[model samples]
Target: MTKPIEVRNPRTGKFDYVIIPQSPKLLSQQCHRLRRGQIQWQELGIDGRIEALQQWKQALLSERDQLTEALINDTGRLSTSLLEIDSFFSTLDRWCHLAPQLLQDTAKNTSVPFIALQQTAVPYPLVGVISPWNFPLLLSTIDAIPALLAGCAVIVKPSELTPRFVAPLMTALNTIPHLREVLSFVEGAGQTGANLIECVDLICFTGSVETGRQVAVTAANNFIPAFLELGGKDPAIVLESADIDLATSAILWGSVVNTGQSCLSIERIYVAESIFADFYHQLVAKAHKLQLAYPALENGEIGPIISEKQAAIIRDHLQDAIAKGAVIHCGGKVEELSGGWWCRPTVITEVDHSMKVMTEETFGPIMPVMPFSTVEEAVDLANDSIYGLSAAVFAESAELALEVASQLDAGAISINDAGLTAIMHEGEKNAFKFSGLGGSRMGADGIKRFLRKKAYLIKTNASKDPWWFNEGESSKDI
Candidate 1:
């Protein structure tokens, strides 16, 4: 039996609604339904699929206001909540235009004598996507769109915390003709996600490294491929020649956006000793100016963490830092704003790798600023973490910045920009270490994840092939 998941308003500390968790049996049934519809879904062809996507795009745009409002209510922070909606719509639009070209079969050159060769991207029949609640819509449907465009049926298991937005989004998409059963959703906790991983042909999961490992193990048991886009403790390096204003703004937004609940959030900052004081002052001033308000407020910049459990973790990390000779530059208290799970945006200095705030993934509004004497030391500090999802280097000299970026052990390194810019490309966005596995869910690589490649060779003439020797009697020379 599954329990009801309370959808709490992090802003008001009130249980706004509850979602009845789907049992494993029901989740399995949804998978079966999706599998049954795969053939007909593929028959819809690229154009037909694009047409359906167009309908989805229009539906999402038509209901943008309501969706944004729901997100704000669910998570708080109106501006940050809109980021999810905006990303969803923009991703949908991009896939609709690119899927046809991306999914097309390609001709290949043959090395075996004179045979014509070709290859096709054959999509898996059913793709399972387990999305996190941090950016619910973006992670949930972003991977699913590529699978659907590649003619695969998708079953999305949304995070139990933020299941509210997905149901309405699915309802809107189902309004399109012949899409009700083709696209499906199951809402529940981890068990439901486990069921999904076992049933599908391929699994795409976005969440913590611990849970992602469990998903990977489950997929391994079932002998299916799994794509794990896990956690990150991303870092930012500011050189002596860096633009203080730009680097400060990027670090502030990069670290505190979505209340530091993002996978690409910059949890650590390494600044050169020459300009460390200037950057620290600017960062503290910006952190102090942030408004931590209720979700109901339209202009709120900082909002509450998702749950008391998460808030406690943030508190523990902060406490650990302060106890370990770290100085809190600005905002370090957990304020009960309207009884909400709110924490002040915190900036800490005199930090080292021993503290939890500097080492672990603090998915809250906490930024640790440490100083380095050389660019090499800065790079060393940035690459010292066990997680390497993304990193950034800020400097006026583009050449030196790029050189430093190239040496960092991260999936994507940004020069004088936010670490999250890695997702903007349509290429491989793989995690270097424990951050994730497989390629990114963007561009052709994203579409290809759900596809298995098959090679074809055809003979133009009836003449015997040159290398037609029997396997039992291998020829020494041709």
Candidate 2:
């Protein structure tokens, strides 16, 4: 199944070079000896790993503009949105700085069979993180930083769209002497990616559920573990009690950030019907204030969609929503003029659960806004999606917002803010989601995903008489 792909660059409309590497079987066999505990936990501790990633961080900072530009070329994201890469770098640094303390080896006495029982959590070896291009640098690096800090090397299959940065990233990583050989990068088209997954102990995948499910299935078939960070139909709720100005800014940041390419992008915006028309009018008028420039400089506020195919998908979703009697309040066009992947910031009205725009993950700059009468209805509407990855709610009262936040079924919830869940739970004891399975790329989620616990029971007394002497067992030994 592993085959080479014919690569092309859309910017110049030219064909690129070919790349091939070891198959999944060979990679798996080679890694067989590199399991957890193969290396001492303290040998390559968090401090050392952080020291190395700091260099990686510096390299990322030094080339931030260039790297963002590369991602822009591939994803058609605004140059300004490219600061998202900077966000990733900062988060990586924060993870490196924080995770060592979180991953400290600790033991506990087990209450179960409370007889001289102990529970210990240890670091495992390398994990395979298959990150997607939508926000590839951030997603992959977010997971990788924690894993490395937890004493595991990572094998990353970066999205093919922005794979250009792999060499630069690996080069930067090489400066951290210890990780030069341990952390590795391998690139290939579709099947070659699958090969990489077949080998690693754990797989942290951030992509479509379809692809994520396949990764989990493939990993499971081989008895390997997997972390599936699939897509989301994230929703933003603007209540009757909301601050219009705050909601306006939050929605713009949540939806248009990265041209709405992010998994947590606010694809669904629900405003209380009492203020629906007013909010819709203001949101559209405010959007005009933001603009995308031509041959755009790096870090531009808006960028193109990743590809013509992605644009077409966005178009189809728009057209389908409209056909189903939904209304397009703002963007609905696919611009061929940019000679790049571009779709305007979209806002849809009169949407319902039946429309794909409402029910499925668009993963584009499409915001489908609707109105509800009560908090009960709004909460239900937001939780209607199969994807429970993230949500945002804006309310006037802190008490009411906290009450609502407690009720919403999401991995992360934002009160009076959007994408706040992306930052919350730092140093908190609780996991972000009742369902997201915890962790916000790092912190508790990072530790839970990367650390597997082993329970060890040691007898305080130097006797095994209890089990050995059962029903005349071991009589000959006595």
| Highest TM-score scorer | 1
Report clash pairs, candidate 1: none
User: Least accurate stretch of 10 residues (summed lDDT) in model 1?
Assistant: 419-428
C-alpha positional error of residue 96 in candidate 1 after TM-score superposition, expressed in Å: 1.4
lDDT score of residue 262 within candidate 1: 88
Model 1 lDDT per residue over 236-293, tens place: 9998899999999988988888888988889999999999999999999988888876
| Candidate 2 residue pairs in clash (backbone atoms < 3 Å) | 76-304, 77-303, 78-302, 78-303, 79-299, 79-300, 80-299, 80-300, 439-445
Steric clashes per prediction: 0, 9
Q: What ranges in model 1 sit over 4 Å off?
A: 469-478
Candidate 2 lDDT by residue in tens digits, 403-438: 877776666677788776455436332223222332
* C-alpha lDDT values of all predictions: 0.83, 0.70
State candidate 2's TM-score: 0.87
